[model samples]
Target: MSMAKDKELVLSHISLEVRKLIKMYAAVNECTQVEMLERIVLEWNAQQSRTERPPGDEDE
Candidate 1:
């Protein structure tokens, strides 16, 4: 599968339970496993952005 150049291909080992969950989520969402994984990562990034503060933004 082709992805944008900004993205990097990841090859990591996951637990069987995690793999099954991803498969189920992909099937329910009608998306490929890769898309589901991307959705998960994007959601995590958004969540972190909401709670994290940048340098110099803190009150003295």
Candidate 2:
């Protein structure tokens, strides 16, 4: 398989429960496991962004 030069592959050891959850979500939505994982990551990023403030962004 070929990947974009700007991208790099990552490896992680995930728990069995999380793996099963990803498979079930992918199957129900008819999407690939990778897509489900990406969705999960995006949601996590958004949640963190909302909770954290950037430098110099303190409340007035």
Candidate 3:
């Protein structure tokens, strides 16, 4: 496994309700909670890339 995959990131100070929601989503989707979060982040990044590109910023 890569070092990045082995390292942990903490979502500190999040509410109990939010944590429960993540757990429930992971359970229903048959993925680990971290996987669910990673999927969400990946989707968010994709969407941001689509709408966030500058119109005249292409490189030659």
Q: Which candidate is the best by lDDT?
A: 1
Winning candidate number (TM-score): 1
lDDT of 2 by residue, 1-60 (tens): 222232213213556788789889999999866677777778888789877977888667
C-alpha RMSD in Å of predicted model 1 compared with the true structure: 5.5
Superposed model 2: Cα runs more than 4 Å off: 1-12, 54-60
- Residue-level lDDT of model 1, residues 7-28, one tens digit each, is 4234135566876898899999
Task: Give candidate 1 regions above 4 Å deviation.
Answer: 1-12, 54-60
Residue-level lDDT tens digits of model 3 in 1-60: 122353244333446787688779899999877776666668888888878889987557
What TM-score does structure 2 among the candidates reach?
0.65
What residue pairs are clashing in model 2?
Answer: none
Ten contiguous residues minimizing lDDT sum, candidate 3: 1-10
Which has the better TM-score: candidate 2, or candidate 3? 2
TM-score of each: 0.67, 0.65, 0.63
